[model samples]
Each structure stands twice: as structure tokens, then as C-alpha cells.
Target chain A: MIRPIHAIQIFLIVAVITLVGNWVGMQQINPVDAALGMLILVAMVMAGWWLARVLPVPFPPIVFVSLLGILLTMPWTPGSEWIVSHTTQVNFLATTTPVLAFAGISIGKDLDKFAELGWRIIVVALVVFTGTFLGSAVIAQAMLRLTGQI
Target chain B: MAENEVVEREFEHNWKLYGIVLILTIIGELIGVRTFQVGPGTALLLPMLYALVIGMFLGPKFVKVVSEKDMSDASPLIVLSVLILVAKLGTTIGPNVPQLIGAGPALLMQEFGNLGTLILAMPVAVLLGFKREAIGATFSNAREGALAIIGDVYGLDSPEGRGVLGVYICGTIFGAIYNGIMSGFIASLNIFHPMAIGMASGVGSASMMSAAGGAAAAAIPEAADTILTFAAASNLVTSATGLYMMIFISIPLANLYLRILTGGRE
Candidate 1:
């Protein structure tokens, strides 16, 4: 659902959270501010929900949120250390585990619909992987060589 | 009662659905948490894969307490998880930022590499007998953003829609699992820079991106931040440009192939 307006709002919410979370990580969140921290997480979910709306350009909400997160925590900023430190509080694994489980179930529900698509999926998946691998490897190797990073 | 109301009522109290998904999530977390040392510096665990496997096991054939309609809520839940992961990924980057000047060319190569996937996929799909629509769909995985392209330009009822939907479905099931494994394998090879592979991993979904990032970070702890930064940056560029590129650049090229393969009928 992440249309332009929604994307802006969602990004703002996460921007604030990244700002506060990083600050807390660097210092300490008093009991009063803890409520604000909880609110930020909730706002983030609501903002994430806006992502369900689909953007005009087809970009996912993750890109916007990440970009905003990065902007809020720029290393050279006045106090970027807090943002980086609290970044771990997001607990990516704990969150993704459930999401993946739900994703599996969502897929299973469409098994009948999917079986009709035939076997080409296997070949296509492998091809996509190979193409990306070769393309990335060739470019990476060349870039490293050109830059003398390798 | 009307059919709509009946359906709404069913959805109103799908407690069993939540319970089942909760159990599945727990199962997945337990497995994802069980990392084993593969080497002095490497470790492995496939939480996403494990969750998917257990979920597939709970399908109608085995467990009917939950219906597709009930699990409908999973969509937003999944998106939220992806959001959290992406935001967290952002944090890992901002500070440990590498030489920005170096990332410029590397990012370009990775983007082309992602587009290269479409170039490679289209021919194989056409060889296997897909037409303009299916071929187009197969050319791009069309996971989250690409789906919009398929729906807008090529009606979902078109062959392309069906093709992209199929690819999207398969990707949902396997993209993350494979992307994670690919990262670990690529990292293990010690050939490409962890920075480069991180960018490659960004071509897939958020979870896939995280898995790829995780593999690189685990393999080379020192370069962990650099790996994540490159992966996020490359992903941002790919997604932002992918829609236009898919429409303006890749589609026309695919159509050329379609014409050649179909004897100019395309």
C-alpha cells in the first residue's frame, strides 16, 4: 500500500525511531522515554502496513524505511553512535522467523494454483540464480581488479 | 446469510489459524537458532527454510484446522518482518560505510548483473515454449515490486501475468532459502569480495537480502558492516531502477527474442 504519501509518513515514523533508538543505545532511555520507544515500534508497524498498499513505482516499503534509517544514523552526524548501537535492538532474527513461517503457509494455500504453472519454475529459478551469480561475479572481480581492492 | 457475511464471520474468529502459525514460527525459530560451526569462523542455520518446510507440511492434506482464508493475515505480518529487517540492516551500515567512491562502479555492475538475470532467463523460458507473456514474466522474478509492473502493463490475466505470478510464488518459497545458501557458498569460495556478493544478494527479497548479508557477515566478521552496506545500497538502486528498466530496456529485448523464436508472430 506504500503510495507516495504513505511512504513519506512511514519513513518519518521509522526515521524518528532510528533517531531515538540510536540515541538510547548510545546513552540510556529513562523510564518516561520508554513509552515513546514503544510508540515508535507501533508506528513502525503501522507504517509498515502502509507498505501493503503498493507504491506507484513498485518499490517496496523496505527500501524507503532503510533509506530513512540510514539517513537518521549517518556516522558523521552530531550523534550517530546511538543509532548504530540500538540498531541491534531491532532483533532481526526474532522478527523474520515468524514472518518466514507465515510466508510458507501463505504459499501452501496456493499449492493447487501453483501446480498448474508447470515445471519451468525449476529451470527459471536456477537460471535467474546463475545469471545473477555470473553477472555479479564478473562485475565484482573486474571492479576489485580495477580498484586494486582484490 | 449472504456469502460475503459468512466469509467475514469465518474470518472474524480464526483463532486456530494464529495458534497454528505461532507453533510454526516457534518451530522455525528453534531451527534458525541452531547454528553449527562449519569452520573456525563460519556457522550455518536456515530458519527461513525450516519455517517454510514445516508450514508446507501443515497444508490441507495434513492439517485443515487452518484455511488459506484464515492465514490471510500473514501477508502484513510478513511485510512487517521485512520492514524490521531492512531498517535493522540500515543501522548496520551508516557508520561502517566504506569508501563511497569505490561503491559507485560496483553498484553499477551489480545492477547490470541483476538485469543480466532477465537477459539469461528470457532465452531459457522461450526455449521451453513460453510465449511473450510467460517469457516476460519468467524474465523477472517480479517478487514484490515487479508484480505491480506485470499487473499494470500486462493484465494479470495475460500469459505474462500467469508467468510472473508463478515465478513470484516459487521465489516466495525458495528465493530466500537459495539466496542464503548461495551467499554462504559464494563466501566460502573466497573468490569474490564479500562486498560484491552482498550486492548480489540484494537482487532478491528482504529476507533473502538479510540471509545473504548474514552469510557474508558470518563468514567474514570484519567486513560484516561493509557487506551489509553494499547489499542495502545495491538493493535500493536495483529496486528503484528495476521498474523502468524492466519496462523500457528488458521488455523490448525480450520481445526481440520472442519475435525471433516465434517466427515474427510476437
Candidate 2:
């Protein structure tokens, strides 16, 4: 079984690979860093897949962290600024817009199911949402008062 | 063997649905942004909602229809999309490190600040008798809505994809609430500082920050620096505490409330 320590090891390995790839690629072709970044991402995915299969624990957080780090950091890496600027805009649109659309569509699709549950789910969602909002606000206000921000 | 085959086939079938959803999501995003001046993140809400609606319509059949491969393929795309969005946003907003540090402690504290309230609220929600599947469906649907487009684009449709979607939605909602309340409270302090307002909103969501900024601007236009400072600080705090708060507090509270309302049906 893969231990948490193993997950850490895998993360370190991925990071090292990315760092070395970035350094070497920076000295060569312009697109090399982006290519290396993609490679690191793919490697992280593979690591996650493997860890999920072999590990007895829930899943490796490191794999996700490694992949996420590489994906976010890729734009800043040497030789990839142009792609980063152009694609970054597209990338945000690609990621967040879909999620929002999906939420709306999914909720709309489940209208009937939600209907069966009727006011219960609505009430619950509203209550939880409101509770969270109110709770956070109160806590924040108190904190600000204490901190003299108020 | 037959059951295994069935599962595999089901997984494959789900991927096909996801593909269609993906294309629709892209179209929706393009149209929304181009036509409405809505940002990509805001535009994404539609496609995600649509997919959840479809998934619900598909019902239990969804389980059989979605294959493991379909789910697996969808996750990476979602991750990619998130990375892209963050990078783009970083550029637009520029770096605001001090704001982040200043707000970080309070934001983090707020994550656990309402433990008693959550615990109290869960039992109340449970006693009211809520449905588990409904709650699960809402949670699941909310997640699917957010990631459906990205998943579709990248051909990801795995359990992992679903997990990411779920986490993202919950995190956003949690962050929004935390930041919103904090900002409102801060405003009440009459500090008249945009930095405080921005920090509060930043710890929540961009939308919240925008709303806070508008209010601050309307009230006092000259304090733009304070507003900018607040936004920067709050944004950092939001990013730093977003995931941590969601995992530790939001999900558990939701689940706890779900269980109580459903009478342990889940």
C-alpha cells in the first residue's frame, strides 16, 4: 500500500522534474517550457492515477497539488510568457464559465426532483446559505472591531 | 464478468453525454462573453446548470450511463480550465500580497469561527426532515454545473472529475459567504477603508469584491487606494483560505445538515 510518505516522494519527484525541465528548456527553444509544463501535468496525472490504484489511503493530495502547481506556474516559467498571456485569458474562460453554466443547467434539469422534495430542499438550501452568510458576517464584524478596522 | 462489462459500458456511455455537454458549454461561454460582456467564469454557470438538469433527467440511469473513463477524462480539463482562469485573473488584478496576508488570518479564523453555529444548525435542519438524495443531488448538481464545460472540453468524466466539480462549487459558495459576511461587518465598523472592504470581499469571491468596491466607490470615491488595497488583501485571503475552509467546514456542515434532515437516509 502506498503511504502518505510515498505521495510526498512522488510530489517531490514531479517538482524536481518540472524544475529541471524548466531550467534546461529555458536555455533552448522558446516553446520548450510550455511543452515541459504540459509534460509535468501529464506526469502528475499519471502519478495520481497510479497512487489511487496502489494506495490504501483515500487518495494522494500530493498528486493533485503537484499537477495544480505545475499548471498554475507554467505561465510564469521562462519562454512561455506569450502563450501565458494569450492562453491565460482563454484558459480562465475555459474553466470558470463552464462551471457556472453547468451549475445553472444542472439545477434546472433537477427541477422536478427538487420539486418532489419541494420546500424542504429549498428551505434547507436557503437556511444553510443564509446561515453561512450571517455567521461569516457576524464573525467578520467582530474581528474587524477587535482589529480596529471598523 | 457481465457486471464488470456493464460497468465499463456504462462508463463509456456517460462519456458520450459528457462530450455533448462540453460542446454546448463552449458555445454557451463564447456567446455569453461575446454578447453579454459577462466574464467566462460567470458565463460558465449556464452550461453547468444545463448539464445538471440533464443528469437529473437521466436520473439513476446516469450512474449506468457514465463510465469510469468518461469521468477520468473530464477531470484534467476542469483542472486546466481553473488554472487558466486563475492566471488570467492574476494578471487583471495584479499582485496584492500584503492584502492577502492581512486578511489571511481573519479569513482562516472565520472558517472555524462558526463551528458552534453549524453544529447547532445541522440538528435544526435535521429535525425539520430534509431529503438526503435531494441534498446529494443539489450538491452533485451544483458541482456538475461548474465543471461540466471544462470536463466536456477535455473529455474528462471520471469520479475524479466529479469530485473536483463538487469541491469547486462548495468552495466557491463557502468562500462567498465567508467573505460577504466579513465585508459587511467590516463596513459597519465605519472605518471607511476600502482596504478593509476589499479584504472582506476578496476573502469571498470576485463578484463580492466588485459589489463591495461599487458600494465603497459610491460612498466615497476619493478612497480608491483603500478600496484597491482592500481588494488586494481580501483577494489573497480568499485564495489562501478558499479550499481549506471548504474542506474542513463547508462540506462537513452540509453533509451533517443533510444527514439530520434526511434522518440518516443518506
- Write down the lDDT of every candidate, Cα atoms only: 0.57, 0.40
Error of 2 at A82 (Å): 8.5
Q: What is the C-alpha DockQ of each candidate?
A: 0.31, 0.15
Q: Kindly list the per-residue Cα lDDT of model 2 for residues A42-142, writing each as its tens digit.
A: 34444544554577865323234333433444434554454344332222333344434333333333344444444444444444443443454455556
Q: Write the per-residue lDDT of candidate 1 for residues B118-199, one digit (tens) a residue.
A: 6678778777767754454555656544544454455333466557656665565666666667777777788878777777
lDDT of 2 by residue, B1-266 (tens): 11223324322223363444454454443333221223222222333333333443333334444444433333332333233333333333323334344454555454443343344345443555533332232222122222332243222233223333433444343423333444455465665344434443443445545544444444555765666565555545544444434444444565666666666775
Q: Give the TM-score of candidate 1.
A: 0.57
